[model samples]
Target chain A: MDPLSLLRGLLDTTEDAARALVGRERIRLAVTGLSRAGKTVFLTSLIANLIAAGRGARTLPALSDATGGRIRRVFVVPAGTETVPRFDPEAHLGALAADPPRWPERTEDFSTLSIAIDVERRTSLGGLLPERRLTLDLIDYPGEWLLDLPMLRQDYATWSGETLARFRRGVRAAAAAEFLAFLDALPADAPAEDALAKRGYTLYRDALRACRDAHGLRFLQPGRFLNPGPRGEAPLLWFFPLPEGARGGLADLCARRYAAYLDDQRSTFLDPYFSRFHRQVVLVDVLGALHAGEEAFRDTGDALAAVASIISGANWLERLLGAAPTRVAFAATKADHVPTRARDALAALVEHIAFGARGRAAQSGAAVSCHAVAAVRCTEDAVARLEGQAVAAVRGVLLQDGRGATIYPGEVPMKPPEPDFWDAGLFTMPEFRPPRLDPAGTSGMPHLGLDALLAWLIGDLL
Target chain B: MSGRPTPRVILDEGTAPAPRLDFGWEVQVAPPVPPARGWSTMALIGLGAAVLVLGFSLLEAGNFVAAQFAQAAWLGWLTLAVATAGFGLVFVAIGRELRGYLALGTVDRARAAVARGDPAALRSALAAWQAGLPEGRAKPGDLGNMPINAACALVEAKTLAPIAQDAAALGRAAAVQAFAVTAVSPSPALDALVFGWRGIRLVRQVAALHGFRPGIAGTVSLLRRVAVDAATVAATDVAVDAAVRGLLSSRLAEHVAGEAAAGAVAARRMMLLARAADEACRVLPR
Candidate 1:
């Protein structure tokens, strides 16, 4: 085992020891989703609902009902957090509860919020029960970071071959043209140069960003290259995957740095959190994918498959890392964007995308479940008379002009849409502005199947 | 709920139902009494009161010592030393009891950790729990490379199952001894002394067998919980706990009368308590 891994293991054991000493129960929850998957809204709403539920708002009925009202109270741990920066619920909620009511900012880097829930369960005698607490440490990491997880098992040569091959594909080739041109000029046997490396890194990062922005392609490796985290534009993230059979000099330089990047990924990103958490919530923007078209949808599926693989496909490594989430809930976010009847189809589509990506991941005792959820509902389900026929519709403040408009947002499919469905032009996706919310989130934020998601995820603990 | 004017919805040139708010977006806020104060606040208040009481008592003792000095010098020094020693011993006893309570808590947390289904947690909790036992115990075969659920079940069976039997044996002996002694003691005082010793000894032996020997306060707490659990068990297990059932029911005229029946009840309670303690030690993480 790596010494860093051993050190992390030791740290985890020490913390567990401390908790054991105090007689406390703690469960870590990781929330990850691809770009524009509504991770921030999900987290903020989850915390708000927990606090709201405690305040008798009844926002989380699934959890409340599951424990039979055993949840006594829920409160955020004070800000003197040592492990990671605290995810401030007040600030996030303030953003949502702003004048016009907007969604919270997207997750930039991993931040944690520890919520202690006092669960009072009746003893065998069903009387005089002392309330036991379960501290939920909710962790939110940038969805971009998820792209780097698959790199752990791949060596520099293998990663280079794979990434370079991907760059040659249809739209990605056009996007990566400049970077590929630069790679052709920079000889493999040339002397190692910082300026050359920096040029290559910039072009590569730009290419990745272009792939994301232009074609809506989601699978870009070395995610921090595009969305450079706390270490902004550092030399450490200054290497790109080289072409196949390219070795020595500049290629050697890139390879060495690539090895270091993977090491950094293991030590900083993978080890600490994964060693602890037993539950995960993967938010997928299936509608966003569908709207972006087939390429983006398939890419989203690939990302979902990789995300689900964290629970099963990479079991040998996860077992080695000691980071298998026994239960995972894959949720298609922004359910209110679609009509009421299509929600089941939305759920099925995500399940197909996630489970169809990897078969045994769900069946291998992981208890994986899927749902169509709106973390913060921005639209109201409505039935509109369209062309003399009652059409299922949604009425909300349209994001474009900030006017209330009832729209037939379009049908959601139970699986990846066929060629005819797209050719027929079936989707009419207009974004919706968020509804006004209480600044304190005391009135409970509106959500679709969020309670079901919670029940599926952590109901047993509740 | 909002003060802002309702936004109007645009409808197509056709029949209209007028889009309205659905039940999915419904929100209601119930009036709730907050948990007035958490455990920490209550603990702080109790601690403050204890400090105040202790300080006042110390002041009175100091005055008494001064008064003794006025009466006699040697007697004053002796009283002061004895008082200091007594207070010092009391602090030590309190600290031990606190540690003991924390140990029992660790046991409870370990069980919870096992139930979480993390293999890492399973290994960690199992390692910690196993450490509590004395060395030279036989390590179980088929320990490596098994599913977490199977491992937990195996641990419960191989490791904890025999401990229960040992505990049950202790309980059986204590109950029989208590019934024999309490039923036929020459005097009430003698019976009380013997029964008290047996209860304490029985609990201590069972706790040690399970590798969770709690101190005075923890023992008392454990006993109280055991009593609660035992009562619950007795109420549920009507066929097995007939003596306890009879005690609760209005069918007293159907069974043995006087001190003998009381002895039987006490014995039954002891047996149930031992079982409860055993169950507490074994955390089944299914």
Candidate 2:
């Protein structure tokens, strides 16, 4: 390398290329969670902080004097966008500034952002003291993707049969059966009927929801089936032979279409999703899963292992397509639900659920780490005294009757009942939503350990 | 059970491949096959070769092509016709891989923009963001990857050069003073610069290994304390330093240092980030 050339490269531009070069590093990060686990909210908040840092505004404790400088600029890129993800400072700041802060909207698919930061270089490194710009790309996606991973292991028949069976058992099945009967009335070769099609689609979605409610299966998006694009047209549904078929001809056609649906699904959703990601964050609503009962817990354990199996076996598919995720983070969401005192116990529960799957990933040379986090603070405080006994409760704003009121939401039961308990009902009372924090409490609720999560995943980029 | 091995089950040479089994076997019909995809690697290599040739030709001919075209109307017309044909081919290729190319380019640009600074790009981005702010279209999150902070730093350094140099020595002192000016608070730009770098360094270690650094462990423990204890900055600084040192020391060997050297560097960066963050806090209008 010519010193003069280097000098010229250094001096020829005022764009701070020198700083970027000095700061350049690569790190991969994945953010994911179960359905409605506040993945999107956490992502947006983390990004908001990063963007706020860009203005040389806001103070982040981790980035304060003891650590280093804060984030300077932020960019968020939607998966298909030309630019990186941007920190929507307005969205977050506005929310924070509101009389009562609210969580960001949930995300349905994968979103990513690559952030760049320029730090003040320390003088002792024997080089020019130009500030270095470090860039980190943080990737966020739906936790549903983790659920779909297990489907890769099942053939078309198995997936459809199991789903159909579940639908038959659940309360939503009556409506579904009616819809299937309607399917029986349609002619096999008749022109597409919009009304019938809509009914059929409704049935599929309803059945999926039923399964989700009763069985805790989360991937319920209906578009995956109805839209297979040009190549998939009608033939795909042949594999998922609908029981709606009353005659031999109808049965044959249904079988063919089911097959097509399965094939299309494998090609579209299963393959690319596993292949594209370089790392994965599997957010388990373990408490919710646990609360669902023994069967639910067992189901979760099975599902997680099943997901792991597919990922490992999909090596062939990944090789055929591209790189599989090199790392996996099996995170337990709503860590804040427990009193801070029992966070370790919550972590232990998560560790038990993830141990087998994580070990498998490690055996295969893929990196796996576990974390317990609360994307949105459901509780303001770690512990509360209820009826004179100290119970772990979250203190935050809640709805009393129809008005917003302060309340101490009771602690998650130390041991929730069996799987049949989910059938009982969701936690409808305001015990989960606590009292609104005063100005002092607002600082950490929206994001906790998000920085450390960011640090662990893509800190090298900065 | 028909013990005798039923005559239908007996093998016979007469069966003889079942006359090639004309269940559409020899019907001259095509098998069900997906449409062939484009030869990507071949095309890319060819395109690369073409670019190389064109570059070499330009270097060799210098102003020759322009001069030739300028001298004759017929020559210019011929050139235009060739250019049009080339464009048509390009359009066809674009149609084939337009989405893929766009996606690749987007990722590439973001990566390049982050890895290296392009002032024109940064200025354009900054202007867009500033303009987008009022319309509620601007996303501050973009600052994370835009290198805009660095650009702002440079802008501050450049703008404040005369101001800083007036009271100090020229050149180095001016640069140092400019950096100081950039550090002036309420500028999340400087805060991000310091924190983002250390954050990246931290993430790298975490991803690389479990317990990769003693610093992370210490940091985690410190964070545990902070979760419950609202300690002042002075009181917490010691714990922070210890944690940062532990983290930095973990990466020392592979990252161009022994434990001591890495610790020093870590201490310096942590302090720098802390200082900048504090300054931002102070300058943040209450």
Candidate 3:
């Protein structure tokens, strides 16, 4: 490089640095969760409420009060990158506001949105200071993709061994029957053939889909095989886990594809987005997992642990060059599905599920906390008479029929349920219809514990 | 048990040539050079000098003998030190504030470019921001792949346009019946069945377009498979509705009804075909 060019570069860097030091601070908030964990809803409500609160609507009491009423204004800003898709808040909000409200489509790929809030300084002698603006960038991605991070550290053989072993037990075994049969028919050293590869890939992909949809399993890997987004129908995603201790042309082919898949995942997914997140909110459907069965519950826990390991155990090169230390919050979603009285139990269950990950994060000098929240409250507390005794219940519109009903869902255990509890019968969690909202604005989207969540996430920043 | 040799069994020819598997991994390039640290060093020095002078002043004020240094020379020296400290503090504060401002400016510029829907401008702004980062700071990777990706997406969309239009027309016709059935009788099983029927129609249409002619029996078989696939997808949709929308409505009914209106099934099939076409073309002798 020319000396003058170098000097210019140095000057430009310094000037930019100075501007950054003085300008509004930018915070990247990553919203991640397993499929159906309410990440989309949480993000929507959070943004709505934040914008509302900025407009003095007073929806989020904790957040509003914490800002000392200095939030002058808040507004949505254009996303900072063109490579990534922008989160369509308008389309989502419109879906909820339709005549017969419908849910928005689930996130299939990563997206981003940014919000800017102007806050006045609060100090005895700072009355002369101008208001400061803070820009928050929210990144949304599927939790299934996050599960693939561990594959970056594993070779094809090891991943295959572990994956095959996992499917051999529990509900997955039944789902994997067809795929397993196909695997058995092929010899490891057999000549590589396109017909065979496609057949194996399709069978395995079908099994993975069945495992998730039928059995409600959360530990499914190679997530893109199920939700291939823009890379749909691409040859790069046509690889499946092979049987262990197999070496030959077939194994070689699968191994190569596996490596390619990992490369695509890292460069196209994690590096640009996951590695850049400054804060992360992990949403877990604790009640749903628990309802599924013991296997599902344990699988969810393992998924959390794996995600935490990746978040806290970045390689030395990445650690030195990655984004700032991240703050993590694990939120148990759909709190309104259970009764208000069982809220504590729900929180406890989530805490227990996240305990190991939380400990690891704390060890890594990152703050971790758990909360039970409902981004969109659907049910309300009520009482029902059962066997001449009053029992706590929840009243809401039945999702099956638009009729009103009161349900006394079984109790949520405060601790991890014992094996015997499984025999005792699990609670039937009914889905409730969302309450009507003011289509005009975000003033009436009822939520539970969102304020507290906000207080925990960005209270200090306020 | 017969001594005659059994008819020899031979597998059919492969649908396509075996995919290449080079397993050639690309080495990650070296990280970007860290931004210049001259501003940071200068700011630190100024902050340190301010703190030292302020601390000394406080200590001197606490000492009784400090008043004896009120002579012109001593007083002048003290005043000069305090002024210098004030200047240093200002420099530090300005440096910190300016850095933040510059960072925010970069994002603001990028956002503006995006708002204008100018891809070139957005790319340019991003590159400029990356170049402005200090030493040791991680720079964003190349966005050169974005245009190509966008082009591919556009091509795929173009390929599926006509299929989507046809599906939409068919969906409009089915919507009336679907709505009436759903309204009159709300049953999860019934909804699943309706969705399964729609899935069958969709698969038949897609298969026909792809030149795979299936008879009635084959169509029914395909329907069974499509139904299973739709049912699986509905399960996920139901979960998503429960968690996000707080609605317990049957996702199968909703999905079928929605697809009927928007022609998602046909569009989706077209997308799949487009991809397959791309792959097949790639493997063709060229």
Candidate 4:
């Protein structure tokens, strides 16, 4: 056996013994977006790719290879307890296997999956081992939940007054004003109703958007209170509204509820998320943000900052107070969107935005790294015609306005470990969308980085 | 009444000498109450009274000068009698209050028992009972022994005053039960209480019928058998079912005596109800 694989085997045996002595390990992952950010599709694909790695065909190179550091096996098992349902591997896998790929339905109210995989170590201690089991505890939830974070920090009157002001000045103010009026009229202790809460939730959501639009607040979920999960439950989610009185009154209520909500989110979402893993990989769709222009880019930055806050805030902070993440890889996803030659530039852009002041809170400690990856290869290198003219294009899968347009967005060069020069503003085109990329040929596997990321986090522990 | 014949009675009664009473007064008799006042008063009065008496005697014996102090003897006797009587009253008052407080405490305990047994107050009472139970301190396989009454109370609480209680308990219960279901035998009865039929299906999917071999699965299989036995008893016992339902859903029923009969009905109903509960807990994507 190779040295990396041998190390992995020792880790696996140790991990098995640990589980026997210490019960089960708990790990968590969180995926979110501001509205319509393709979170569902990305998550579904990430998991599908992870599971398909061992099938030989359409495998992730990082997970299936023996020589390189990679994951050897992946299995979807029961979550923490048998009372809850097992993670639906078939549901996600089936979606990826369809003739025309489709995104999995969005998840709400944080869901968890405990996945087991055998991962090979990148560094060698000699050929005395084979492979070890590395468990990944994944969590998925709606982006709308992020809105409640800021609420936890602010009171109702302050939240409301500020929201009202945004309604008066921002783009969605007209709709926001009407929704604000409805929220203002709600009885403090009354039972929540879908009709009433819907209006209020929508207004609050719109207010978030309006604030983001005007003053560049990053947490815009529900886009306008479209509801994160099943309706009715939305109202029960305690959010801080601007306090009605300056001294106390409604502010206390809002603050109290906000604290309760924050606690709930932590126990239910945050705590369980970080329990099982030693590393983290945060995926960002840089192309989409670039397409949306400056405001979207700024929102993405703020969103990264917010992500940092959440990781370093009360929830993640309490668990990892002094012990920071052993390894963190902040990835710019969907690298196929850019030409291979500029893949490094794309990675640089993501690194700059993700590690900037806004994302610093989340970036602290650990060996932070960045990458550009495409889980599913869309196309190979080739020139293509566009707009009745020969343009420098690389062949790629593209879903163009509900139709397939086989066009090369551009050629992507195999990236060096550290590139010499790069710029973020080079790609200025808006309205750019990937045509439905066909599944890559059954090449051995693609992307070794995913497993390397996992190896770095828990390789020693395993 | 006259038609019935009166049987002749033969008395074998004979006088039996009672065992010699050897009761020790020191053992049975209560300790004597402590003196309320110091010994100085007794000594001073006794001395003065004796001195006065001695003077009187001296006068009677024709000692003229000592006869002048005779009135002082009556005054000293009066002071001794009054101090003894006052000390007695203080002990009596202290004894009475102690008896009253004990009586009050008994009454309170009886009232709590009655409240706990009341169908109207069942839900909250059961909640109080479970909260008071040693749940968190339980060992790995200990959950199988959770009383059926507590489970019944939970079901009732969730179904009736669902608004009052938050989801914290349900979530914790879910977590604990999850451990039991996965780590122990997948007992259908406990499964019904935890997730119902749907949960059983999930168990089947995640765990091999034989288990994951050396780890938590082995622990689970052994615990599962024990849980099943307990569940079977709970299923047939009406009181057990009521308690289980109360503990699980917080619904308290009126009758506690016919629990065996009630449990039979409940166990049957649970076959269907548990499936629904499990389905309800499944989270869907937006």
TM-scores for all predictions: 0.62, 0.48, 0.59, 0.46
Give the residue spans of candidate 3 off by over 4 A.
A1-20, A79-81, A125-127, A314-324, A386-389, A424-428, B1-286
Model 4 lDDT per residue over A1-462, tens place: 346534544565466457635424434344444444445555555565555453223344333333353544555654455443344545654554444444455455455566666554444521223344555666656655655554444545566676555455534455366655665566655343344444544557656655544433444532213344544444444343542443333444445555665676656554445323445666676655654345456557766665555553323342343223445667677665555666777778777767552245344555667777665444344444443444444343222222223343322323311221122222322222222322321121233244544444444454
> How much is A201 displaced in model 4, in angstroms?
3.7
Angstrom error at residue B101, model 4: 92
* Candidate rank order under lDDT: 1, 3, 2, 4
What tens-digit string does per-residue lDDT give for candidate 2 at A1-462? 246534433443323344346565333344545566556656655655554444443324444333355344444432355332443434544554344445444444344566655555543531233345565556554454455556545654466566566456544356367655655566655344444444565566555555556655443433343323334334333223244323444444444554555455555555433434445666677766665545556556666666666564334334333244556767677776555765655666666776667766676567666667765555544344444555555443332222322233222333333344444343322323322322221122344455555554444334
Off by over 4 Å in 2: A1-23, A26-28, A51-89, A92-102, A106-112, A118-134, A138-155, A168-198, A211-274, A292-322, A355-360, A382-388, A399-426, A429-446, A459-462, B1-286
TM for chain B in all models?
Answer: 0.61, 0.16, 0.26, 0.15
True interface contacts reproduced by each model, as a fraction?
0.15, 0.00, 0.00, 0.00
- Per-residue lDDT of model 3, residues A1-462, tens digit only: 346544544554455356446657677777778888888888888887777666556567777777776786677885554778888776666666565567656678888889988777666423334456778888777767878887888999999999999988888889999999888888868667777778888999899889887767778888788778766768877678888767778788888999999999988887666665556777899988887777888888887877777765444433333342457788899988778989988888998887776776666666878889998787778777655556777777654444566676555778888885565343446655667654433352568888888778887776
Interface RMSD of 3: 29.5
Which portions of model 1 miss their true places by more than 4 Å? Answer: A1-23, A81-83, A122-126, A311-322, A356-360, A384-390, A424-430, B1-286
Q: CA lDDT of each candidate? A: 0.72, 0.45, 0.65, 0.44
Q: Which numbered prediction scores highest in DockQ against the true structure?
A: 1
All candidates: interface RMSD: 13.5, 34.2, 29.5, 52.6
What ranking of all candidate models by TM-score puts the best one first?
1, 3, 2, 4
Better of 3 and 4 by TM-score: 3
Residues A249-347, candidate 1, lDDT per residue (tens digit)? 788888889888878877888776654566778888887777666777788888777655553553544434444566778899989987889899999
